[model samples]
Target: MIRVVAVLALLRLAAITVAALPVQWVALRLGSSLADRLPVWWHRRALATLGVRVTPRGTPSSERPLLITANHASWLDISVIGSLGPVSFVAKSEVATWPVFGLLAKLQRCVFVDRTRRSATGRTAGELGDRLAAGDPMVLFPEGTSSPGDGVLPFRSALLGAARAAILDSGHTRVVVQPMAVVYTRIGGMPIGRADRHRVAWYGDMDLIGHLWGVCIAGGLDVEVVWGEPQIFEATTDRKALAATLETSVRDQLRAVLRP
Candidate 1:
């Protein structure tokens, strides 16, 4: 355990010291394509170092102007999902102000929304539309928060408004909304029950430092990422209905993994 934690600490220090600065400079000078790819590389390395294994079941949409709506489980979800492809996230504005994570989010070019302001969605939607049109796959956690991993929470439909904005702002007739689910299935090659899985979830009043320590010690953590069938968001599409469809797809996928 001590050796694993030491290796992880060294890996983080090396990444921040040796790789992060140069990668940031390259992404800023070149463009977002490089920015998109660098995070995937970093995330894969982090997962490798931490012994977290990810099994991605389905493909992310190849369609341009894509919005992938996923259920959130833990802070590790970012690394698990990021390792899959060149994707940016629709994160809450507060994440942009966090310590090391804030810097990482900026480097990844995540779109930050102030969820407190009801009026902000329209403006964020415009930004999301522009990003989607530009060929960036944007990930939105419609649940708007992490869950306990036992089950998914009800998705907040208001965030799905960005899909509507994509159609209107980008001049696209339709946008593809893909549903995704992330589930933690095992630790040390043994299946984790609901009671044990909560230890992997970083929610509520959990302290970030403590959770980081716990994750470092948790061995052979296995996660599954499943992408559901894509839905088209058209001008006439109902935002609430779209959100409900995504929620059901994600919930079903998660339940599949939790089942024996």
Candidate 2:
């Protein structure tokens, strides 16, 4: 019965993706505002179809040239956050090569960063800065990799350089770096224990197809998204210190939601 439900859910998801792909592509080509909005609708519908409920706390900052720093836990983080508003992501370059998902990411205007090559970091930072300068909200998963939904990995300060870059490029006094957290708290309307986390969190060498199927079969996922106070990043702000502060904010929020 679970397998049947998973199959049905997967078919619905595939249909949604197929239906949106062409419209999003055209919107992007024509530079329409729909390009910024369709993803939100799509994600919300996807979440609904999969029986994932998102509880957003706090508010996303309204400031221009904003960069949101969040902890990574699973692939569903994209949909959970995307459903909130129009925002692009800063993802690893490898994601651009992923089948189907890569195309979807491109449509969402994600900035692909090649983390393996130190030389590419500067270029990617500049691109991110340009996007932020244009008043585009960019979501950065500073943890660099997804965790098991139990803890946050240490955030890398390198990409935080984009904040400084945005300040310079836009001639803005400061850029707002908002800390956000995505926590998977429950499944099937019950609190999730450590052992059940694997069913929701996708990390390490887990196969994407299998994990996705598991999530579809299990369904009834509850995620909490907490937005922390926005920190102003000025020319003199220390990137490493800022990264550490954001990391702490996210970790604290995760603990509050997961343990409370």
Candidate 3:
């Protein structure tokens, strides 16, 4: 029965990828004005393929210059949140060169940054700010990498500088930073524990294809997306301090949501 489900998912994924072409072309041709309202369809398609149901908490921001910081759980985090609303992602620089996922990220207008190079940090943040100033809300995973569905990692303060630049220089003082937490709660309509969760969260050195295979054969993938209250960053606020606070809030939220 599980094998049958996995095969079905693989077929669905292939079809969705093909169907996204026209949508991508039209959105890009119009200067990406349709961009902020796009990608939800792809997220829906991804959900259908992966058998993952995302239950969102708290409302997304209604204003421009929004930054969403989510704890990275599985690769599925992308589709879960992207499916929630139309939002771009701040992914690692190597993602731009990845196989098929890279193209999808570019189509979604993702901002890629090279963490090893200090020179690129400002450039990447500038790009993020440019998108925000252009009224595009972006999602950034501050852990710099995905972790097992165990606990939220302490966020790196380096990337939070992007939020500071946008609010201070761009005159967008009230920019909203929405902290999000993703927790895989159940499988096959039953509760999943730490050992079983490995089928979902793909961490260090985990091969993508193998992870997908394992996930596909598993029961349903259920993710709880908890969005913390919207925080307004101003010039008077210390950026790093605010970032740390946001990190703690999100970590707490994740722990709360994951409590058994």
Candidate 2, 126-194: lDDT as tens digits: 888889989999999999999998999999998897557755876787889999999999998889999
| Candidate 1: tens digits of C-alpha lDDT, residues 136-189 | 889998888887886889888876776576557667888889999999999877
Against the true structure, candidate 2 reaches a TM-score of 0.98
Q: Candidate 2 at 102: error in angstroms?
A: 0.5
- Indicate the residue-level lDDT of 148 in model 2: 93
Give per-model TM-scores: 0.93, 0.98, 0.94
Candidate 2, residue 206: Cα displacement in angstroms equals 0.7
lDDT, residue 83, model 1 = 93
Return the number of clashes found in candidate 1: 0
Q: Please give the distance, in angstroms, between residue 79's alpha carbon in candidate 3 and its true position after superposition.
A: 0.3
**Model 2 alpha-carbon drift over 4 Å, by segment:** none
RMSD of each: 1.8, 1.0, 1.7
Over 4 Å off, model 1: 1-18
- What C-alpha lDDT values do all the predictions have? 0.83, 0.92, 0.81
**TM-score of candidate 1 to 2 decimals:** 0.93
Q: What would the C-alpha RMSD of candidate 1 be, to one decimal place?
A: 1.8
